[model samples]
Target: MIAYSRSIRGIERTEAYARTHPVNRYAAYPLTAFEQTPIAGTQGNRKKKEEAASQGVYSWLREAGQGQKLLGELLEKLGRHNGVASKEQLENSVHTLVDAMNRWESAYQSREQLLRPEIWEAMTLAMRHPAMELLGIKRGGQEVGRRLVWDPAILPQNPNMEEVNTLRRVLLGSEGLLMDLKRALSYAEQYTPMQLLRQPFIHMYPYVLYYGAAQAYHPLPPRGLIMNKTV
Candidate 1:
């Protein structure tokens, strides 16, 4: 086409070339989509299924709560807190921290990132949807908006190991994930302070509150994580 267009390629075959060979098609990039597994246990995957049966959730929550508790104190000390973190920062952090740690050898094969693309695919699929959907959280509104609150309370239902694993893969394959997350949360605070105190206030999760404690004190203490009332 360009060859026949004088304006594009300095050629003069315009009418002749077009009539002889009509352009009929275009190409598109492949959709790198994830292949999700069913909730039901399948053959050879029993272990992965039962893994969900364990009290992994309770343990995770306990640990997370402890982390948040600590984070709350830390924030009070730093005087840098405003409110609960918006969904974007939380999402970014998940990718950043896990990816940074994904490089090490794991116990299983599919669990390993060097070979399996499914792990990344699964997460990419989840990310395409709101993070809340796969996690079974009560989701509303759009995360891409200027503000979207991530209520820790809405996240404990579904084991998001698959999602987390995906983040680990991306972050591990490259560097700068963690720092990127930190900077994102920080920038959101600066550019859109409302990002911290916006609508749909999410109740803070324990571990996050503890870890980010230094970042959530005073005017925005862990206790005030859920601003749904006044918010």
Candidate 2:
């Protein structure tokens, strides 16, 4: 299993710091007063910008939520099967997951200011390796067993407080599921489905617990709040 002790400790430290230093009231409104209130003939342009920003936020939340849900479903399915899933099923699930991730990433990129820069950077980096792995799996054949080509620039960065904690919990849970699936794929190649059946179900309680806790946290901003800002 991928050890998350370091990540967890980092999250705890960040949370403590956040407790001591609260976000500024105006941090959420990055736009200047002039930008916030459209002047004269710029009303039409400002209206379009607000609409786009609103849509971007909506898309990000929708796609991110869908990806999380799909990840949970895949984990539950793997737990049920004892990590003996067929390659085809794994490929399909990974494809869907990657697509949703891509959509959300695009949405987030369009509105990076919606989230704290540190949080956005952390999330993007956290997603890269798994996304590469999942894409390789989707391509099948020699790709599935290939080593990850770690990017030198993809180093870990500090995350902001409660949101960071929620993100880390979700990332760890998803990473565990991805690792399990990759292992199962390897086993499938060596043994027939019948032979794979004898393998014991890997306990997935930790993944389930992490995912459950992250869900309870609701890291994303409320839709109404986001809309209000755009308006």
- Per-model TM-score, in order, reads 0.17, 0.36
lDDT of 1 by residue, 58-136 (tens): 3323433443344344333322231112344444444333332222112112232222333233323333333333333
Worst 10 residues of 2 by lDDT: 193-202
Segments of candidate 2 deviating more than 4 angstroms? 1-39, 83-85, 112-119, 128-231
Model 1: per-residue Cα lDDT at residue 75: 32
Question: What is the alpha-carbon lDDT of model 2 when measured against the actual structure?
Answer: 0.45
